[model samples]
Target: NRCEYCGDENGPFEIHHVRKLKDVSKGTEKWKQLMIQRKRKTLVLCKTCHTDLHRGTLPDNRFAA
Candidate 1:
């Protein structure tokens, strides 16, 4: 399979989230908004991109304009 974020076809991959455990009733964050819009909680991502995500190092364009 490929990473949903980086499109990396790598094994030993990790899912960003398993389910929407936290609240998103009034989420203004891009990621949270994306999740709400898509009605999906999971994001298949490579290790590198996943780390960059948690670190908030990913570029704003990653989410697109």
Candidate 2:
């Protein structure tokens, strides 16, 4: 599969949650429900893109260019 961010199809890929799981508080049922609902909001990213995303340096047009 190709990376959703950079369209890289020849490297290791990882599922990246749009909303990081760790950022969601686990202290409430509502939060847990929201987390479950938000699970589908993910993107397949290549290792490089994933790293860039974490570093806040991923280009907005990474896949378009």
Candidate 3:
């Protein structure tokens, strides 16, 4: 698959979310929403891109610095 960030064609791509459901809701709501939004809401990204996205380094980084 092609990575959503860098367009790298690689094996074992991961699902990258715009906003993690757990970050929005908690407990039961988190699980329910996550399950419902798992597929259509994620982008396919490579390992490096996935790590950067959550590591407070990428341009679209989601983690707190």
In candidate 1, list every pair of residues with a backbone clash. Answer: none
CA displacement after TM-score superposition, residue 35 of candidate 3 (Å): 18
- The lDDT leader among the candidates is 1
Candidate 1 ranges beyond 4 A from true positions? 18-33, 62-65
What would the per-residue lDDT of candidate 3 be over residues 1-64, giving only the tens digit for each residue?
5765566776468886656545534434322244345544566767876776567455533212
- Candidate 1 residue-wise lDDT, 1-26, digit = tens: 77666567864577777355356536
Candidate 2 is scored at a TM of 0.59
Q: Ten residues in a row with the worst lDDT in model 1?
A: 18-27
lDDT tens string, model 2, 12-45? 9987774655554452433233445556456677
Off by over 4 Å in 3: 18-40, 60-65
